[model samples]
Target: MAETEGKFDFAIDRGGTFTDVFARLPDGRERVLKLLSRDPQNYKDAPTEGIRRVLEEESGRLFPRDQPVDTALIGWIRMGTTVATNALLEREGERTALLVSASQCYPPLPFPCCWPCNNERISVGLRSHKGRKEYDLQRH
Candidate 1:
């Protein structure tokens, strides 16, 4: 329960460049490890190896001889990875509509209005814009 805290805990963070693991013990001490990310295979394997090494070292230091850490002695084991790569590359974002003032209303799309949605491709009303506006629609 909340009153009882785990003796050992683990948490991980996976980023584009590296994977990080953080482990803490009831003794108010912690260990951190960073590993290079591997594509396709995910970034957990590397951190797992790192955590194993840390556990071994801690076990040796605490017991002096060969002793296994009891499961109950561990607090929590957390793992996570960053999976935003696809979304970043695809540029797939929220679906929303843009409202333009009457002065700069035009088929926002690069070319003329198509069909179906006829979704405004590109609208412009700003005077700073190089393109024509509603008033100069006939100019260009």
Candidate 2:
């Protein structure tokens, strides 16, 4: 069996609904865990809880919820999340703006609009048009 030089490595994927964890132990053993993203009744954070579970299983010792894990034992952890994508899909966040080169073509949106330009620097200003706030992009 391949060994990990006495360190644990973990790869995690945290989505809007579920979080998955994959761990590699020092002794070449592998573990996987899946849990709910939001389970306040059971755990405060899914990734942390998952790591705790894996460590407990390896050491055969139960770790208390309030105690911090031995991070020194872990070699590395890679994590990814879909929270931002979910927020964007649902349109549940604050108003935002994007700045790009004037020569680039961007698909028009109903609320925030952009105009075609040929200059290098574009100055953007907020204007009230027909009782609605709009973005006025002008070349500088």
The lDDT for every candidate, in the order shown, is: 0.55, 0.80
What TM-score does prediction 1 earn?
A: 0.43
lDDT minimum window of 10 residues, candidate 2: 108-117
RMSD of each: 15.4, 6.3
Model 2 spans > 4 angstroms off: 1-4, 96-140
Q: What's the lDDT for candidate 1?
A: 0.55
Best by TM-score: 2
lDDT of 2 by residue, 21-121 (tens): 99998888899899999999999999999999998889787888788988887888899989876776677675556554555655543334334455568
lDDT of 2 at 91: 70
TM-score of each: 0.43, 0.65
Collision pairs in model 2: none
Candidate 1 — which residues are off by over 4 angstroms?
A: 1-6, 39-44, 61-73, 84-140
